[model samples]
Target: MSTIIYPAPIFGPVHSRRLGVSLGINLLPGDGKFCTFDCIYCECGYNKDFRPKQKVQTREAVREALEKRLAEMKENGPFPDVLTFAGNGEPTANPYFPEIIEDTLALRDKYFPNAKVSVLSNATLIHNPKVFAALNKVDNNILKLDTVDMDYIRTVDRPTGHYEVENIIEGLKAFKGNLIIQTIFMKGTTEDGKDVDNTSDKYVLPWLEVVKQINPRQVMIYTIDRETPDQKLKKATKEELDRIARLVEEAGIKASASY
Candidate 1:
């Protein structure tokens, strides 16, 4: 199966469907993937399929690369709308992630102060105090919450290590409306022939309840856009995504749907 393995430290001034003109900040190695979760839908593919020989990028390397990229962008054109920490694997998994965030913020201020700094994390490591603090500092702390059901999680998300949805919800609550909740709604069957449609009320309602409890600034509901590792999976229809977005909107929260 085809997959994307992004270069470490910095990449792109690529247009993002959600964030817009995003400058990617990849903390994981360029060669392969390293993540806490092994979601079937991941564009980077399964962890076992693409293992990195190189270690995670260091704090200094991240800072330097980001600075260089920012300088070039400043000198040329296509200024970034957001410096996004999303590529390959989980950004917070990097040992120097917090420090890198600090560096990124400083550089952003020096170059594009108006631009936002965003991190796309799986919400698995928020239990770590340092990771929590770092997330709090960013302009957009976007955390993934596909569903609350453990069965669904195991079937689709398939967390590699210890991951409890209850714990994740609590950690999200601790954010106190500072974070953005990103959810993927899809319709499909896993390779094992088990159904995996999460757009239904069975998944949406319970997930929405937790979203309300978390009280995030916004909820980004999206379907599969690019090619996923799992060929059996299908994108959630625009109508279904809209319905969920409306539910979130009705709850007095801002919601965006990307089909």
Candidate 2:
């Protein structure tokens, strides 16, 4: 079984392949994983493996913790390049996400005005008007979109309930030019030995069409960088990622591949 990745709420000015020098802000409860999607590639492990007794952090607590970390980083030098909302689970699931984003913005302004504020969301809660509004205020409103195929999504992302791929794609489109779409391209099988691959043109073409519709500022193409819930899964090579990125570029969208 894969271990829990992030057990703390506020952790590290860690080096990120996508967002440089990131300070993670986990909006979920400190002791467990809670998310709308149970993706096979999730580095934090399968959702069923996590259930914590701790409660979600209050807005005040988040504010206080962020302020303390920012102050410490400022005094010590090497201020973070980005304050990212990402960890064990969904940030927006906290119910106070709008208010948290507001606090983070203010704190970012106070500490590192030039640094970017990003959210590494699964894009599950964007239907909420408050969440949508708050996401717009960030420097990088990164949203996941592995493939446009619903079957592929169901196999990998496994969004809870009757959640549809079209719904997520449309919601991301509503972001207009404010969105940064992130894709994790890979080919392999699930733990059950089920074949699941999205690295082919069959998946990439339609996915690019959705990207064109969304017309985001940037498209982040990456592969599994750490161990995932599905051991049978294989990571996409940097070259394959670049090839897919070239297609996005051809469609007049900016892109980057992180292997």
Candidate 3:
């Protein structure tokens, strides 16, 4: 299987289609992919494909690297608009996640006070109190919620453990509008030839209702940008995403779509 692993702990002032000019903080190992979900569309590929050469980054290591990058950017180079937590896999999987967030916030305040701190989480760990609290403290707590149907979740996003759709929805609702709900829209055929299409209303309406329930600050809807692990998958059309965005707006929730 073709895959991409982020080979560094601190890299990127890349232009994020959603989060603007962002400096990424990768808390996972530089060599391996560690995540709670093995989603079919994950650009980093499935968790099973990973083989760790480096241990998961520790809090101090992340702090040192981030501070070095920030000081350099602050002193001699361009500044970032946001400090994002995203890399090879789910950043929350890092044991030192909460502390890393603390360090990232302090560095952002010291070097670029105006820069927003964002975390892209899968919502599986939202029930963890420390993770929940840290997410609330960030500027953008982007949580993933692809479909309300459990079967679709299993066939598509593929949560790794004792994941239940109803339970995760309740957990996501705990954020109570303090979060940004990010949904990736796509279509593909399962190994058994079962069709999976989350962009359709049969899926989107129930999901939008859950969005109304969670009542997040905004909903970011986007389609596949990079090559997915599953070659059979296709990105949602811009026209389709636009229609979905309008539905979100009509529900009184702020929405943006990146096609």
Candidate 4:
């Protein structure tokens, strides 16, 4: 199945189960995707044939667009529940992420004071002081951590050369309880037909260790809800997601399954 691609900075005031009515902010260019990790389950599709060159909207342009949208929404009355930083690729990959967040926050305060500022990052940039500071400014800092086992993480997330599992975990540990961890569960037959199931105890155990170390405020567990580039992948059943949530809860962390 072909993935739905929205080529713009502001795509929708779409309904989000976790974030309510979210107004999306796409920092990456509309014509291409730019992210450090090329995950198998990414809704934007795999980054195999794409380059990671950045061509993000300028801070002035994003601010202007957001202000105009907010003003229009205000004139129409009610506003979206959240102004979310999410799009074709990792939002934090934009060099001006911190400035963007600051500008967004200013707009949020001026136009849609009731709405929250949310950022969805892959966690690769968490180690950067600027990125961390920017994330700290947002209301919802949703970071991704699909797995902890190095081999599986490498296969699943396909992170860039600079991103190591240990470094990510180390960065996350500094987050304390200010972070929300997002994990997507799935089962699939690899290109070679080998079954890939991260739900198994072998994978979950090591993953849990990292979760414990990070101690995030909440863990949002969900399965495939949209079309992915890889058709061989199978979505984890609701029952499977619930079981995994239970494991996370038992570890003294809050878990919500959106399967």
Candidate 5:
């Protein structure tokens, strides 16, 4: 069976197990996709050979669309539970990310007071002071940290030249107790067909160190539910996820698994 793909600026008020009835706000280009990491498990498909030419949507454009959608939804009776900043790629990569957050907050207050503003970032741009400040403002600051081991991180996330695992972890630590760390667990084959699984003690031990350092409010542990570009990839079982969650909680951190 073919995988379901949702592509558009305001694609869905879809049911999300984590976020719940989210009204998606895609900051990246509608036609073109731009991302810092080119992971094998990307649901948007693998990053293309050429760089995305189109720029991210402006703050005004995002705000206007959100306001209009909220107004329409209100009149229609039921509205989304959250206004999620998720799209083709990393939402924080936009240069005007802070301004966008500010505008979204304002719009949320005005139109849908009950709705919360959430951002799904790769945590690559958290190293930037401005980006960090912006992320701190959101109701749900969902940041990704797949692994802490440099070799495993490189193999899993496949981040760009500018991004360093140490730098990303440092940025995350700077957030202290204010953030939510999201880890997507998977057992897959690398592009070259090498076995990739971080559930083992050796791979997860380093990640636990980072978790202790950051001390986030919550740690979301989940495995792949959708088709990825790499056909050889396999999803981790519920029992495996539960075991990892137990380890995380044993370390005095809150963990939730989505199997």
Candidate 6:
């Protein structure tokens, strides 16, 4: 199946289920994927399948492109609800990410002060001091934490480099309720017949414990919405998602489920 590949620097003002009318800021190359994790459910497919031919857009270029887009939007009819840092890869992976966030905030203030700046990160680079600081600056510092199980993460999320869930949790706690926890819950079997379901109490309960420890401002629990590279993977049911959300609410934290 064909996968979604976004343009470089900037792409959409597409309607987002969670963020409303959104403008995307793609810091990675437009041609392919450059993420730290090779998730089976990623709409962008695997990293090796789509190696980027072009270099990551420079901070200056991103600023210029965003300014142009915001300018057009300001003159045109539909104003953006949020300026989102998302695309084919991890936005924080860009070398100039911190600088770009600073630029984005300045431009947002200039063009649409009402529009929120959001970043969708895998949470791998949150350990980096610069990335951590930059994320704190954004309106929505959305970080992914699928499960606490390391085997599941390695088999499913497939981190490219060194990744310790304990280390990540420590970094997340540093945010101290300023961040949002985004988790993707899905159920299905992989090509090799291993079960990929993570919506069970085993995963959910453990993940919830971590979320409580991190104590994020909110939790976004979502399922597969688009076609994945691994066709064997399936969407987590609405019932399962809602059940998990209810559990989060019971813990006195806000939760939103997107089925």
lDDT per residue for candidate 2 within 1-259, as digits (tens), equals: 6565674569888899988999999888777788899998888888888776788778998999889989999999678999999998888888888999999999999889999999998898899999999999999999988888888888889987668888888899999879999999988899887778788889899999989999999999999888887889998877888899999999999999998
Model 6, residue 27: what's the lDDT? Answer: 95
Clashing pairs in 5: none
lDDT of 5 by residue, 118-222 (tens): 888899888788999999998889899888777776777888767778878888888878899999888878769777887888877888888989899999989
Q: What lDDT does the true structure give each of the candidates?
A: 0.94, 0.88, 0.89, 0.84, 0.82, 0.94
Tell me the RMSD of model 3 versus the true structure: 1.2
| Model 3 lDDT tens row, 1-259 | 5677885688888899998888888888898888889988888987787857788899989999999999999987778999999998889988989988988898888999999999999999989999999999999999999988999888898888899989989998888789999999987776567787788889999898889998999999999898888878888899999999999999999999997
Off by over 4 Å in 2: none
Q: Is candidate 4 or candidate 6 better by TM-score?
A: 6
Query: How high is the lDDT of residue 68 in model 3?
Result: 95
User: Could you tell which candidate, 1 or 2, scores higher by TM-score?
Assistant: 1
lDDT of 6 by residue, 149-248 (tens): 9999998999999999999999999999999999999989888888999989888899999999999999999999999988899999899999999999
Please state the error at residue 176 of candidate 1 in Å.
Answer: 0.7
Predicted structure 4: lDDT: 0.84
> Which residue ranges in model 1 land beyond 4 Å of their true spot?
none
| Per-prediction TM-score to the true structure, in the order listed | 0.99, 0.97, 0.97, 0.94, 0.94, 0.99
Tens digits of per-residue lDDT, candidate 4, 1-259, equal: 5755555677788898788898999988886677888877778787765543547878888888888898988899558899999888889888888998999999999988889999988899888899998998899999998888777777778886666788888898998889999988899966657566888888777888889889999999888888877778889988888998999999999999997
